[model samples]
Target: MLYNLYNEKKDNRKEKFWFRAIFYLFLLIFIGTVCWIFFFSSLLKINSVEVIFQETQTEYDLFNKDYLISLVKTAFQTESSGFYLDHISRANFFLFNVDHFSQLIEKKSLWISKVEIYKKFPQSIQIIIIPRDGAFILQGEEDFLVDGQGMVFAKKNDFLKESATLPILSFEMKRSVKINDQVLESKSAKFLTIISSIFSEQSGFELKPEFFTPSLISNELEAQVVIDNGWKIFFNTERDPVIQSKLVRKVLDEVIKEKISDLEYIDLRLPGKVIYKLKGQPINADDSDAQESKSESKEKKDDRN
Candidate 1:
């Protein structure tokens, strides 16, 4: 019986030792995997990057591909911590977050309107950028760059060495504006875009866009465009811009054909009607009607005589 008890105790000791050994093996493996992913794995690291602009070759110079890639690499290198075990501490494949990286690019570049980042598995990334159209420049206490979306992106702190050919907007604001503010109203911006498209569509017209002045009429905002040759064209704030542009083009064609001179302003506030005043004549529909009646009366008197 004593020998049997001693054998049973030995078997029990061996079983406990084996269990502990297996448990420690699994623990070691888990730790090693964690370390490899967090510190040494290259699976999620960005090995290659591609930059694509939605513009033509001439526009590519505005955004440099090498500069963008350098910015992205800098972002990846500075990541401190993340949610999953795949934290991108040192370019680990599983640790890189594309969304966060794209945001970093956007925060650095102000003129970019949209950014799309695509990861092509194991090691490559593609970035697509859409930049804002430098439609107009707002000149006030300082000059600001305004796009077609009416967003003022950067100041005239000498970022762009060459001046853009876009019109200068003279905004009448009650308060000062900051960068990224809607300095030029959306309606005005849209009007200018539509007008430009219309002018382009017409074959024989050579319209040169210039400055715009914002005004308030009857509690509604309106804008005026000063074109080449001292012509002032007005726009209604709430009307259809397409129709208004067509009317302006028609009027211009007529004026050119008739060789009209001493023009003052073309007002297009009323629907289906154009009201214009000459340099020294303040004639309107009422005045025209009154003058026609007097002329008719004089003709009748002469016939009676």
Candidate 2:
């Protein structure tokens, strides 16, 4: 009995030793994990921030390394420490609120492509931006620069002072052409192409429309073109646009040859017939007089009977 009791005590002591060993091992592991999380994990640390821009303009001060560092510090102090790890950060938060950013950029007259954010670690955030490429100016009430896709880009400070001799688009902003949507109608596209070609071909020919009016004949898809010479040219989209353009060129050549400065209107809707209204001709007046005379003769004959 004494021997059995001693063996049982020895086993109990061994078990206790193993339990203590396991407890100490677990404590060490937990401490190591905490240390790694606090010191070694990148989630808790930021090192350096890189700010990149699309065109690297002098206007974007945030693109500067020093400016970006200061911004990151400011954001860290104002925002939560885990802001970088969060779904949205100060750098990319602008993207989610695109309308706000767009408005801000417009208000500041600055163009932007994209704003990107990257976490370097202990306290650094990288902000990258891609700016829009300003293409042409849309001449209207609020004249603004338009990109290739007809998207209105933000204006720069020098944009107002310095005139960029880009091609002008005579497009009436209708409900069909939404603010953020692209107007890709074949007629409009073709007209723009023709205007571009004209500008490319002749340096003297600048695009200046007398008035941009829409017509309901083609579901308001057609726009009347009036040049500086008071020559009204009807532009139809259903017909072959290239052919119509050629006809217009022919008529212009003829007008120059004939020395015809005054023309009422030129109708190019028909294929072969070019109905042109001549200057100094009483249109509809003669017809009205003839109808009146015929009615008077009919009344006299009725009186005689």
Candidate 3:
């Protein structure tokens, strides 16, 4: 009876040992397979890159596709911590840093407001480029597209067909302003948008952009809405456009009675009055927005001198 009990115990020990050994071998094989797939195999490495411009149509065909693709390739090879890549030709799909790649590409152009990246799995990467939209077009001899952030990102030729409908901010350019320039500050850009919509709503006609000059006004702090050759309206770009627009409505309804034929210009920058000039008249005075006007006039004079 003792010998039979010993044999039974021995058989159970052998079964447990074999089970553990087989389990370990399978576990090792699984681990090795995973390592090969993730780290060593070309299957998970980046091989193909595709870039899409969010707004650009496929028919347009990218103007600088090769350059853009080069930019993307450079961005992909780059390391997360540094601007340049280490000697690696391609990154593993799981290891590509999307955030870092986006930042690197966005810095390459002011026109690029955002960049989105997606791993198309196994061996491909997809990139989407979102170009900035214009809040207003700064109409110089060369029209420049201005964004809500007051940045000039692209020229008229570079912008799409919708440029015609956008409100204009015509500048009598004494000096050339180029791409990536902050032609208007953030507040002024917001200010222009408000007043442009107001003018469009009130006039019942599409008006040209408010005119600006380096010497006089409309660079940033002030804007002039020109009617004809010498006809215009002056605005304090700093004030609330809603209140100013309402005051303009009041002046038209009560004072001028909407008779603009003889009107030369209306100045809405004054403290208490809406000052205007007619064809043959002297300047309808305020305090003539004295402090504000005089200071701006002085700056213009200073620029002139």
Would you list the rank order by lDDT, best first? 3, 1, 2
Indicate the TM-score of model 3: 0.65
Q: Would you give me the overall lDDT of model 3?
A: 0.66
Can you write out model 3's per-residue Cα lDDT over 14-128, one digit (the tens) per residue? 9999999999999999999997788667788787888886743333332344454566667565543221245333477787778877887788666678999998877888888
Better candidate number, 1 or 3, judged by lDDT: 3
- The lDDT, on a scale of 0 to 1, for candidate 2 is 0.47
Q: TM-scores, in order shown?
A: 0.62, 0.39, 0.65
- Weakest 10 consecutive residues, lDDT, candidate 1? 215-224
Highest TM-score, which number? 3
lDDT of 2 by residue, 73-143 (tens): 45434443344445334333222233443344344433455566555544565566555544444555545
Clashing pairs in 3: none
**lDDT tens digits, residue span 1-305, model 1:** 99999999999999999999999999999999977764566655567767676642243233344554465555555652343445434444555667776787678767666778787877777778766666666778787877776778877553433533555556465357678887556766666555654644642243455544543112132344333455555666455555556555666566433543555566666544566656677733212223333554576689799
Q: On a 0 to 100 scale, what is the lDDT of residue 207 in model 3?
A: 42
Residue 201 Cα positional deviation in candidate 1, in Å, after optimal superposition: 2.9
Candidate 2 similarity to native, TM-score: 0.39
Predicted structure 1: lDDT: 0.59
Q: Is candidate 2 or candidate 3 better by TM-score?
A: 3
